[model samples]
Target chain A: MDSENLENINQMLEQDAELREKIKDQVTEFDKKTRVMTGLLNKIHSTPTNQLPALLDSVQPVLYSCSDVTAEIADLVPANQFWRWKDTWCNSLRNAVFVATLIEFLRSESLMTIQQVSDILGIQPSWKDRFVLTAEDYLHGVISLVNELSRLAVNAVTMGDFEQPIKISNFVKDIFAGFSMLNLKNDTLRRRYDSLKYDMKKIEEVVYDVSLRKLAPSTRDA
Target chain B: MAEQPQTGSLKSRTAIVVVFETFRNELDEHNDRRERLIKNSRDVTNLSKKVIFLLHRIMTEDEPTPKPNNDRASRAAAKGREKLKEVQNLFASIRGEVEGDRFWRYQRNVSPGLQEYIEALSFAHYLDTGALISFNQVQQSLSDEHGVPYFPLTLEDYLLGLSDLTGELMRYAISAISQRGGRTIAREVCTFVRSCRADFETLTPYYKELRKKQAVTSQSLQKIEDATYAIAVRTSEYDLPPEMLDDVVAMVSGS
Candidate 1:
């Protein structure tokens, strides 16, 4: 056995470890920004529904900084190897996407498309680029959105915002219905999709309670 | 309330459905490709295992001397090469699925088969030339007639596959040790495996799975050392000629 052959392999592996370390640093920075954005978004649960637009506006600076960190992370990844180190930063990226989607939802009261999330993150949505956001990440973000909305539905009622729960219940149900259309394999996405039903049920119960008590002025009100 | 806004209007409801419909098609395509890659990868693994088995069978079937140009060894090498062609074809068939970025996307699906192929290739290489196969050599075998690789070989897979080669070499050494001129080959293999272990130790921290494979490599090296040690002690105790001593030992061991 030539010692040089093993030496070459060792060098390549060392290079990979070094690259991953740099990516991890950027990902940690990205996570910090998303955490701040999440903190700001969490305030939506307490604020009156009329003040959500102001809250969403206030989160824009952190979102832009998060996108900047994402760009730096993207530069660190080699071409055509996004998925190679995807696992290292996948959770943070998903969290960032969830934050973006939630803000979009609060702003427009509709689902944010993958393209929209990509636009906000300043990365391509297509896999042609190594730094692109994948469809799985987008879908996982949407699923997280569903979970967060369910919690928001309960909190909205606690804040004496009866109509907000109705809107959340209807929005969650629509997203859940959309998810049922997907033929998900037995993967993380499938497991998350399975749990989506519980969130849906929880939102439905909130809506059920509001309607039963006649707290909501109109079920048709958003 | 100033004005309660309607969220799930007929327009927005239809829009969400359309968006999800697109996501559905995209996800379904990805899932289908992934499934195909996984099934093909498993097939490759099976064929590579067969190649490994065939090589082992050929090398052990005849007790050839340690000479590099021994006829039985060449014949074994030729037969193993022919069998490995099937495994290579299996890889070539799935080349398009893993082309470009898709390769990285589905690398986990492809890695098991690729590593197994490396193990088989390196084992055959060692048997033929009594040397470790270089990463470039393995990648060369995986390339097309035009010299373009079906997909780039990852360093992780290359190293992992080489680590697995130690186990095969250990088995080969043990099976060959009792044959004519087998002790020399066994010692050569032990040296090679020990060197491989020492080299791979520096890399274990970079790859978690490689660390696990290193543990197995250590075990394989231990087995080879113990077998060679037993043979050495037995030979030292015997006063007969080497051939007669081999027969006596074989009989005592009930082989």
Candidate 2:
């Protein structure tokens, strides 16, 4: 009975080792594709989003590859959430990050220059904003997103870097809204910045009160 | 009728073809550039994310080094405080000898009106640092540092160093004025007491405004006291000016 039990345990160990080797190869393949897609998407983002197609015809291939990779990885892993301890190098987190990154890349490609962006939305351009601040419409839209992100990032870091699916979904919504704002579809979405406008009004009130009080002594002394 | 149909169709077809081709070429160029930038930026962002992940894995997952003892840290901090006090004392002594002589000489040159500003500064310093420092101390520090005697410094030069003066003297004078019962020194300080009251009153609005603005700056808070200081000090000691006190009080109070 003791000899038979030892044989069973050894057989289990051998089977586990073989399974891990197979999983390892799959993870490597996933990693390679992720990197390739990441690189191509980065190039896409670097171009002035509007003039992007003039540079090359590389996007269709990358888009096709992304779709294929997503399918292959889905089949390779069960539950599609995270890499097991043995497969920590590949994960659902990686896939989500990649997809989000592509979304941003698309945004950068479209909103290349503020002037071109501003023209689409039909706003007066100021020389100071263009030359001194170097602000274009697309740039301003990007800044708004970045500011919102940094505000949330601080809280996320303090909360042990835990992220829920809701956070990712919110990011997608914001990115979509931002692109719309860059184009002609901004009228309804413009109300989202109403709070900021309200805050600026409060600032103006305080500044006015400060100047008044500051002059009080001189006024009285005179 | 046959000739008309042919020319009309030819013109329309050529115009349509030309417009479509130009539009297509322009769009192709725009899309290409946009895609490249997006791809490049995404990669950089991804690389940063990966690098951060790698570093975090190293720092948190790797074994941690032990921290030093808290008792030892406290003892070291105490020693540092003592060393700092020693350095400040040394500077104070050197400062006194140098400023005393320089201020004494300048005292002879200024009008009696301006002379009080220097004295007020000295008295204010004494209240603040408990070091019995004065305006003369400032002149002496400069004179001794550079081995120059009685070199006249400009009013701008004097104002530039209002930090050291304000840190200690301003608080001392304001508090002394508020108390109003210390002695002859206190009596002299009381002349400026109205100013302090006015400043405290003025500060309330500024505080509310700052909160409303979601902003805070040192200058705004100091305005109240500075206004009071000017009004109280400017009031004549023996004789009150015509309606000036009422105006000053109103101003200081920010009414």
Candidate 3:
């Protein structure tokens, strides 16, 4: 019986090693896609406001690629084990959401609705996709988007798009109101929410600074 | 026909917005439920730790012959029981939300607390009944306490809690031995731990963390074994010197 127990332990150790290797490979692929998507996002960030459409077009394919990689990762881990691995890929998903919101900001000058973001990524909004995105993932993505938009509001003023700060302020205020309606539990989401108040203040200050200088976009566009 | 298709597209867009709104509401509800569950579970974990400390204190070094029925021990046990009842009430409050798919949402938050509470409950049970508490009994008690038909004590939590129980038992054995030559208690603890180690062997394959806990359990069992062995050898050779107790304990634990 002792020998049998030893054999079982040996077998489990071997299986554990194999499982880790398999997960590492999938995570690496997921990381690579996120890095590429983030690179494209940085490019969009630096490009002038008028040049965003072309940059967005270039970034769309990479977004699709990220969705595919995320799907693969969801498949690689057993459904029961997804929670254990969820943290591993959350940053990438957050970045993906940032891109989605950036597209919304660039095109519509409003917060990207979750449905539109899901449509953009070609993923389902519900966990029914099992191997795709869920509402929490989307929320985390939106949370990250809020953080980015606050910085973008400041940067847009530096780029002489003074009206962008005001637009972002309103949009972020709307998002913040929407977030406040929901009680958050996930540690990362809650931490992000706490920072959102500061984001709101930062964007408000940018709008204040722009108005003080009377550098609002209208006269320049006129 | 073209007008119909345009209106159809418009209607679907409205539907998408409606669907997204419902999804958002659901997410908010889930987050609220999850936060409450975590807060309650953390309270349970803290309360259960106090229960554990109480149990540790109640465990006598050289259990008296007539078992003087230590007043302090009984009082501590009663306090532990009351805290457990509060934990049950907390679970009952969340039980409605924990149905269907929502259980997994709160599982991670509540699992640690559940395990700690189980350890406390099982330790209390051993003190009361002088036997290991069965998993089925634990579930039944929880269900009864909450007045719920079904309880969600997962098998993993039960096993993990049982493994933690062994660590407490090891401490008990060491304390008992130091007081008044508790070879009998130590041997009994060894036998119980050995069976637990064997029982966990089958489960180690499914849970990575369980394997680590099992390794710790084995070491705990070994510690008791070596301590008992040293106690026996030292007794046969010479009176256990009070000054050498620390060295003997350190040497036994190290080996």
Candidate 4:
């Protein structure tokens, strides 16, 4: 090899190693934040429906810390390499979105929008930086939220919150309708969306069981 | 499109919704293009495999005996050429759908097929001309039939494919070892593989996949050397006297 070629190879090797090390650090930070968010979300899963707001409030500090680390990751990753590392960082954001949306559903009995989740997570709309999460990433997060809500609907009936299942059933069906309008080609997201129908079906079953027995919230509360 | 939301939350909500709608459209188009490219490339890969099989048959039937009128091997070579043409056509269809940045994005989908085709084409070229096919020759053969710009195969794909071509050459060397001029063929292959290994070492740092392949290429070169050494030892056993036998063995083994 020529001396020029040898010099070029040396430079490239150094650059590749540096980029890999930086990405590893960012991925580690993202993983740590994701763990905190998952821990908080698990608490919501076990907490009773009526006491969800209080449970969420207790984890408020952790939510801010998770988002802070996410922002740091966004700043650290270069724009061009974002696609390669997207699955890693977006997975972390997906967990955060899942928990934030669940907290929103419990508090207002309504669907949480992407903007709301971003607000909850303290994520800046880093459109110019371009390393921040996209709406599509949050959509994936919402898809996971739909899956969790289906299980929540069944559990709510057992917890004597029959009315919550009705709200969840409606919210999930609405999200499914919105998703169906999109021409989705991402196989992973498409497959996940296909299972939304099953979640809708399960929620419907829970709603039917509650209604037929007059065990719904309106009747019991009255 | 009714638009009356001036509040910060509502404005950002609208933006997110609009962005997602655009993103979904882009994803749909990208997936469609990717799937189409993969389908065409797989056809190319299958055809290329058939071409390699034909080449293997041709080599197997080629013997030193006076059966020079054996039409079957030539017929198989002819059929392999036709299959290679079909591969070129299939690749043309893929090239039509992808260009510029799209080519780079979908490269991973078609790279394996392209590399396999390269191995087959190079093997066939070597058999016919007793010369290594150049990258320019591969490019010229793949010229677009539709009068469009010729699709140039990326150097990365070509080099990767050429690396795999060594494995095919290794297989050929192993089978030819029992025939006349077999040791020479094995020696030539060992030299070629060693040169390829040296060329790739300079490129390894830039490509992680290439680094892995270079390691495999080194092992392949070693195997060819070992095979030739066995042939030399066996040949020397018959021609040399006991005192001279040890010296001949040492020379062959050292080389």
Interface RMSD of each: 4.6, 21.2, 7.5, 6.5
lDDT (Cα atoms) of all candidates against the true structure: 0.83, 0.36, 0.69, 0.70
* Per-residue C-alpha lDDT of model 1 across residues B185-209, encoded as one tens digit per residue: 7888889999899888987877899
TM-scores of chain B alone in all candidate structures, in the order given: 0.87, 0.21, 0.78, 0.78
Better of 2 and 4 by DockQ: 4
lDDT for model 4, please: 0.70
Question: How does residue B117 of candidate 1 score in lDDT?
Answer: 88
Which of 1 and 3 is the better model by lDDT? 1
What TM-scores do the predictions have? Answer: 0.90, 0.23, 0.63, 0.63
- Model 2 docking grade: incorrect
Candidate numbers sorted by lDDT from highest down: 1, 4, 3, 2
Instruction: Show model 2 residue runs off by greater than 4 Å.
Output: A53-60, A66-96, A99-101, A104-222, B1-255
* Sequence-dependent TM-score of model 1: 0.90
Instruction: Give per-residue lDDT, candidate 4, residue B178.
Output: 51
TM-score of chain A of 2: 0.38
The DockQ of each candidate is 0.46, 0.02, 0.06, 0.08
Candidate topping TM-score: 1
Q: Candidate 2: lDDT of A45?
A: 30
Error of 4 at A211 (Å): 2.7
Q: Tens-digit lDDT track for model 2 on B129-180? A: 3333334665553343365633444443343223222322333333222111
* Candidate of highest DockQ: 1
Candidate 3, residues B1-255, lDDT tens digits: the string is 222222221123333344445666887776677778788788878888888887777666334452433343465566667667777666667777666444655678878888888888877765565456776667776775445633456667877887788898888788767543356667777787777788788778767778999999999999998988886787668676643664576577852
The model with the greater DockQ, 1 or 2, is: 1
